[model samples]
Target: MKLSLVIPCYNESANLPLLLDRCMALDSGSDIEVILVDNGSTDKSLEVLSKLLPRYSNCRTVRVETNQGYGFGILSGLRAARGDIMGWTHADMQTDPQDARKGLELFDRHGDGIFVKGRRYGRPIMDVVFTVGMSAFETLLLARSMWDINAQPTMFSRRFFETWQSPPHDFSLDLYAYYQAKIHGLKVHRFPVRFGERAHGVSHWNVNWAAKWKFIRRTVDFSLQLKKSMMVVNI
Candidate 1:
């Protein structure tokens, strides 16, 4: 099956070269195409991709002129993807591209009725704690067993993706997808993957406690809205 992986990039020029190198080194023979979405980057990202396109056969790009949100960028690339299986991961290189390849392999075994994601390891303790707390909160709030909500290489078949109505345009996209997987009775399968420091540049939100607080507030607001929407659909 052809698998398309979307990397949502926002000012990730400093990290793209090495990221593309790692992605290209992956030998997944299932016609793996890496769609790098330029999420309104003002940096030299587009130019770098232009120069590097000839180096890899599986590399392509989708440009978003206005910076919307993390989910919006991936959605833009997903809409443009030409693969039977579609997935998305971060551009910061925290999660290895090989892990995404591994996620693709799971499709063969699990079939099209499963949703795959990485269960991250090797992150800082505080970050891990934050993720665990957020996951727990979402599980209870949404009445679904949510875990690793921000995990990478989230994947599903084209069949599953077509059922989405109005997905969020924010980081809450992760939450939306995972919850929808449970809501639709899809098997939520997760594989262990090591999380590492970014190859270049610091995190956009995971910097400090204050930033984490802001992220938490934003996410909680989105989660509430999503739950309300789901309730309306059920009614």
Candidate 2:
């Protein structure tokens, strides 16, 4: 099946060259195309991508004129994707973009009735603790087992994506998509992927305890909203 990988680059100028190189490695076959979304970057990211993207036969871009939330950028790329299988990873290069290939293998095995995500490894201990805490909270709050809510390379069939309604336009999109997969009864698959440092810039979030707290608050709000929607649906 054709696969489109949407990577959102927000002011990721320094990492573009190397990121594109790594993406080139994924383009060795015809079934994959990478959509690098220019998420309203104020840096040289757009210029660098303009010059570099053409060199990679399997890559293109969608421009979001203003910097929106993380999920907004991803949704932009998803809307432009031309693949039967679609998903997204980060531009920070914290995880190998090639890991999506592993996700693709799962789809090849199980067909479109599956939702795939990366289970990150090699992260800092505090991050792991944080992930576990959040996962537990979401699982209880949403009444569904939600592990690794923010994992990379979240892949699914276009049919699954088309079912998404009123998906969040922030980092909470990860949780939204994961929860949707569970609620829809799609088989969930997780693969281990090594998480590492960014190749260039620091994270927009995940920088400090304060940022983590903010993220937690927003996610909790979104989770509650999701639960309310579920209740309405069941009514």
Candidate 3:
């Protein structure tokens, strides 16, 4: 089966080369395609991608003229992808690009009608604590296994994706996909992967505690809205 993976870029100009290099190093046979998304980067990212993408035959670019949300960029790529299986990772390079291939390997064990995501390791102690806290909170609030809800290499079959109804257009897209998988009775798989530091540039959200708090508050609001919507559908 063909697999397509989207990497959403948002002003990640510096990281693009290494990210593309890591991706190109993978065996880019006809069965694999990489979709590099320009998510309204103000940096020279689009220019860089224009120059670099031609080097990889199996890679292509999708441009979003304005920066929306992370999910928006991913969704744009997903809508444009041409693969039997589709998923996404980040541009920050915190997780290796090979994780997509690893995630797709789950199809060997569980078949195509399953969802796979990374279970991150090797994060800083505080980050781990924060992730655990958030996971626990989401589990209690949303009543599902919400661990690693934002983890990369979240792969699922194209058939499963067509089932998405009103998927959110923000970071909550991960939560939306997770809950949708559970609600629709898809087999959920998680693989342990090493999480490393960013290859370049600072985080847009992790700039400071205030930024983190804003992210948390926005997520909570999204969670509440998602909970209400799921209840409405009896999902």
Q: Estimate each model's TM-score.
A: 0.96, 0.98, 0.96
TM-score (C-alpha) between model 3 and the true structure: 0.96
Which 10-residue window in model 3 sums to the lowest lDDT?
Answer: 23-32
Candidate 3 lDDT over 164-235, as tens digits, reads 987877888988888889988888999998899998989888777798788789889989997898789885
lDDT of 2: 0.93
Q: Rank the candidates by lDDT, best first.
A: 2, 1, 3
After superposition, the stretches of candidate 2 with alpha carbons farther than 4 Å from their true spots are none
Task: State the weakest 10-residue window (summed lDDT) of model 2.
Answer: 21-30
Q: All candidates' lDDT scores? A: 0.89, 0.93, 0.88
Q: Which residue runs of candidate 3 sit more than 4 Å off their true CA positions?
A: none
* TM match of model 2 to true structure: 0.98
Q: Candidate 1 or 2, higher lDDT? A: 2
Candidates sorted on TM-score, descending: 2, 3, 1
Please tell me which predicted candidate would have the highest lDDT against the true structure: 2
lDDT of 2 by residue, 170-234 (tens): 99999999999999999999999999999987999999999999999999999899889889999
